[model samples]
Target: MAVAPLLVFMGAAFGLPAIAIATGAFTTSADAPGGVRWTLSNLTTSVHGAYLTALWGSVRLSALSALLATVLGVPLAQAVVTSGSRALRDAVMSASGVLANFGGVPLAFAFVATLGNAGVLTTRLHLAARGWSLYSFWGLVVVYLYFLLPLMVLTIAPALEGLRAGWREAARNNGATSWQFWRHVALPVLAPSLLGGYVLLFGSAFAAYATAAAMVGSSVPLLTSQIADALSGNVLVGQGNVALALSVDMVVVAGAVMAVYVPLQRRSARWLA
Candidate 1:
């Protein structure tokens, strides 16, 4: 009884929508004579040409953004965990919590204000003359890093905290230098957590929509934007089924990311245990 309401909410909010999308992806159009016929045409259409390009673009963007986040986040997380100042640590964690959830259209506008063609820094630095454009792929990368970095920090902070200080002491007592200690002890223990964090960031970037949509419109090929276009019939009429097919594909990719993440998370838990 305690969890019944939550179960009902999940069924309505997620279960029903997922079922609808899956069914619609395989169902023939209503105009067809038969009541409902299953077809693979929608999935077939979703895998070719522009759709294919969008999918690949999304994969590349997610991988790059996540990789950048991991590279920067690990050090930042370690710093926060090892800092002696409680106030500083609290401030950073609080900011991270807020920033991690700050995305969509507002984040896009914020970037525009800072890096757009007529933006303060852009104009001041003459970035346009230097051929820098905020609507480009690298520009998106910079914007994505804003949220991705914070998310990575929050995800890895707990793992960093789990690092027992005694291990470092033991390493030092054993004549291990700082570099040797990290390479031999720290890195190995943190490996699973780092990989898991990367996977989480990858999925977050993969499913993102509004920020990219607002920043570059459809000029940037991405799966989420393509789904929006298909559903809105912006490019071709009656592409809703195709959009559903793309959603299915996105779900599959997310599932695969988790499939890898779960194992790493379990392994990391063993170390902490």
Candidate 2:
């Protein structure tokens, strides 16, 4: 009974909407006397042409952004974990928490103000002359990094903390060089956690909508943007079903990512346990 309210809230907020979308994805738009008929056309339509292109673009963007975030974030996390000052660690973690949640229109506006053609930095530094455009694919990557980097740091920080200092000390006692210790011991231990964090970052970038929409509109042709376009009647009159089908595709991708991540996370937990 204590969890009843929570269950009800979940059902209403997530379960109901998901059920609606799943049913709608398989429902036809034909005006029969009773209601819509079951059809697979929406799923077929969602996997071809512009929709396919958008899905592929989103996958590439998410993969690249997550890869960059992982490359940069792991070292930053290690530095924080090994820092001598508690104040600095606290400050960094606090700032990371704020930055990780800082996305959407406000973040988009901030990027525009700082990197757009008429932006202060652009105007002062003449970045346009350098062939820098803020409304392109690379620009979206920069914008995504704003949050993804911090999110990576936050995700991996706990895992870094979970690493035993004794392991490093034991490696040092055995005359293992820094590179050797990391390559053999430390990295193997952290591999699962690191991969889990990377997958989390990938999903974060994949599901992103507001920042992309606010920055590039439809110029970049991301899956989330295409889904929005379908639902908003911008692309076609009766594409709501198609939009639902695309959403299901996104869910499938997310499920596959988590399927891989859950085992890694469990392995990491076993190490910590």
Residue 256 accuracy (lDDT) in model 1:
100
lDDT of each: 0.94, 0.93
- What lDDT score goes with residue 207 in model 2? 97
Relative to the true structure, candidate 1 reaches a TM of 0.97
- Lowest lDDT 10-mer window, candidate 2? 28-37
Task: Please provide, for model 2 over 1-273, each residue's C-alpha lDDT reduced to its tens digit, 9 standing for 90 to 100.
Answer: 999999999999999999999998999765434569898988999999999999999999999999999999999989998988899889999999999999999999999999998999999999999999999999999999999999999999888898888988999999999999999998998899999999999999999999999999999989999999998989788788899999999999999999989999999989966
Question: What is the overall TM-score of model 2 with all chains considered together?
Answer: 0.96
TM-score list, all predictions: 0.97, 0.96
Task: Give the poorly placed runs of model 2, Cα more than 4 Å off.
Answer: 30-35
User: Against the true structure, candidate 2 has what lDDT?
Assistant: 0.93
